[model samples]
Target: MAQKSIRYNYFLNIFRIGFGILAGLFTMPYINRVIGVEGLGKVEYVNSIIAYFVLFSALGIPMYGIRETANRRDNLKEKSKLVIELLSILFVTSLVSYLIIFFVIINIHSLLDLKPLIVIMSSTIFFSNIGIEWFYQGIEDQRYITIRFIIVRIISLILLFLLVKEPKDYLNYGIIVVLSSVGGNIFNILYLKKHLSFKGFTIKDLNFKRHLKPILTIFVASISVSIYVQLDVLMLGSLKGSTSVGYYVMANKLIRFTIIFIVTLGSVLLPRLSYLISNDKEQYVVYVKKSLNYFLIIAFPFTVIFLTLAEDFTLLLGGQEFLPSIITMKILSPIIIIVSIAYFIGYLILYPQGKENIYTIAVIISAIISVIANFFLIPILGHIGAAIIAVSSELVGVLIMILLYYKELSKLELISVNILYYIIASFIMFLTIFFISYFNIDPLVNIVISSILGFLSFFLFLFIMKEEIFLSIVLDLKSRLNQN
Candidate 1:
């Protein structure tokens, strides 16, 4: 069962990466040509604000749902009962969220001029909160989730090409997002239907009081995570202009793609880790060490490449108008690497131990630091300042979390070998890129060549270090190919 989950996760990661690349390639030109940097920034700012509301609407149900389902996996009837109860909770929460957004929009309508767009986009929150995919995630049904995402992306790309015409078409873009999100939810619902009948499901069996404490804790934790994650763009728009917001957002989006890859790995490991931690502490430690080692190995080299190629990547994806964000991208790349590790450790190691309050406190501290940084930085440095603030705040948060994690789980060892390998590989990759770029090569070509060399050098370093995680991955792939 564990092996199946791992394989499923591997496939989903590949699917997600491919989908991201295609979506980026197709949508970048459309967005850049139509809305331009400033327009894109405005959209991003609004979306970021909406994202917080979305997080509120979610109330961390997905996390709670997965944990519940995993714990009750042996009893199908109990699992179904839990699912029905969770779905009921989400339904009420989502409706309340929708109403809150409506009232907020109505009250701030004159100030923000976000009436129709916010109204249309609010449906996404409700649809996404239906908790359909939570079941699949709990059972490790990655194939279904991956297929649904791929189809949604493909259809959304078609809509973008067919409908989006000019800068003013931002309204249409928002509508398309709402529509695509609904379509994805519908697919998830149908997929869920195939696994269980909702005919006899009821809320009567739910242990609401028993779960209330944990649910509220998860909610607070989710809000804290959302604040640090989404508040920067919101604050950036308010402090600086939307165009400045847009440049920083574009850079942040690209960095987020990197973080998504790492998060995918974390998502795959979390349920298993949660289950293992309850049953076998020693085994859980082994899994945590293995997962963290893998994360460092993959994330360090990518961070180096992102820092090296930030300028070229920004220019290629967002065009010359967004050239100012080059520095922002470079500054934030390493932060994403750190954030990826922090997220993995928090979800898989800390939260499962019922230490969500510690995680929440860490995120709150980071949020406060982020708010301060943005207040000071935006006036002077603009979007670049936003990026700097983001990176610094995340670093501070992760450092605190690491200390807390050690305090909570004193048995877990920080593997010095993993840290040493990552640092050495990152240094080598950074130097390789520096030399390549210093030779007066064309920026685009230099980025490509440097990226190739950086990747190769990183992998070679890992190989020389005899990293068991990398070796295990290699052997697994070879064995799968041989079987095929």
Candidate 2:
């Protein structure tokens, strides 16, 4: 299969990411009013529970599959066999996960009420195996993946609005959520023929054992990472009930929404980076450096914007019911930079370099600290505690990775002096937005205006300072226009 240019894939991913988030953002205010905090919290808590099942069923295969598939992209026969082998393993794992969840829901008296919601959401685990999105990522075929995601998400959004009309309709919301995920997978399964052929791969040709060790290593890392990420919601729900989960997840989802942009920027590099590690180490380092610089430029501004306008964002996006999330959002905003760095270090660098062990260790240690902290903190401090722990744990994980890879990191010079320009520009933008927020304007109008002016000032400053990355991008665009 022929691969598209990195720029092409990146834009497609960005369009899909932007569209999906915008759709959710468009619907959230209505949903928040209709469902209310407690109702949303109930759905979030149930979804978080089902997320664990999905994570286990996945078994790190998604991450592993991306690298393995990219490695074999030039060899269709090998790629087919590898994909089949991974899918076979995924099938058993998802089936087992479903059975286990079924037992938990049926046998636990407290969960009896949520059984229907849980059952609906749990189908996501099974369909996840069929989706094989990792396969698409590995081949760097963002066009198909992006289109399928946007279509399914759009359909789900329409269904959400149509079906979920009241607080009592949270179950309907849950069903739509499942359909969103499962629907995408249905397309994915059908679209496999574009790149992969199942022929000539007998059962005997499949080699699960060859892939087992690396898959398991990444699986362990994935589990640790999920525990670190998801445990907060679980603990918050358990200790403070669904209302608190709603507040926390509201804040979290906003941060994650911004993070999708940052993640997408670097994620397109993974298959290429995986390929480059063996074929061209020098080029790999160059991409990593450029990506890190771009991450900081994007992340710092996002962090500052959220930190400055948390109230406006919270009020606008989630409405008055989500006021508590304002502070939570502020606490979690810095993770934009932290996670961008961690993603660059872990997925782009460590996994591609065959250092899943190091990646695993960092997150495992962080997860341990998170679990311990969450236990002590959630009961007393509630969602605020969870937010604090989330930031700290991610920071710790990033520090560990940097510490472990200091020698190599020093060579790459991941931190650029240009980041200073980004910081100054962000501070200026922050002031611009902060000043705007003081005016007695409508929340929605104020935010729209503040965001425009803030980002405008940010770029104006970057242009004045002649930031290298910004200038480079400008010159590249100019060149492209001239060519056209």
Cα lDDT listed for each candidate: 0.76, 0.87
| Candidate 2 residue spans exceeding 4 A from truth | 482-484
Please provide TM-scores, in order, for all candidate models, with all chains considered together.
0.93, 0.97
Which numbered prediction scores highest in lDDT against the true structure?
Answer: 2
lDDT (tens digit, per residue) of candidate 2 on 1-484:
6779877886797788788778878887888889889888888888889888888888889889888888999998999888888898989998899889978987889788888888888878878889898898999988888878887888888898899999999999888878875667878888888888888767877778988899889988988888878999999988999989999988898889888888876778999999999999889888888888788878988898789888887888788778999899999999999999899899999999999899999999999999999999999989999999999999999999999989987987777678888889988998999888778798889878988899899988999988888898889889999999
Clashing pairs in 1: 41-246
Q: Determine which window of 10 residues in candidate 1 has minimal summed lDDT.
A: 1-10
Q: 1-484, model 1: which lDDT tens digit per residue? A: 3336565686776677767665775577668768787667766766786787777777767788777777776666777777777777778878887778777876874435767667777767767776366677777777777777778778888888788888888877887777655558876765675566555545575665666677788888778777767877887788777888888877888788778777877787777777787898888888888778777877888788888888877777777888888898888888767887788767887777778788878888888888777788878998788788888877887888888767655567755676887899899989888888778776668777888898888878878988777778789889999999
Instruction: Compute the lDDT for candidate 1.
Output: 0.76
Candidate 1 — number of clashing residue pairs?
1
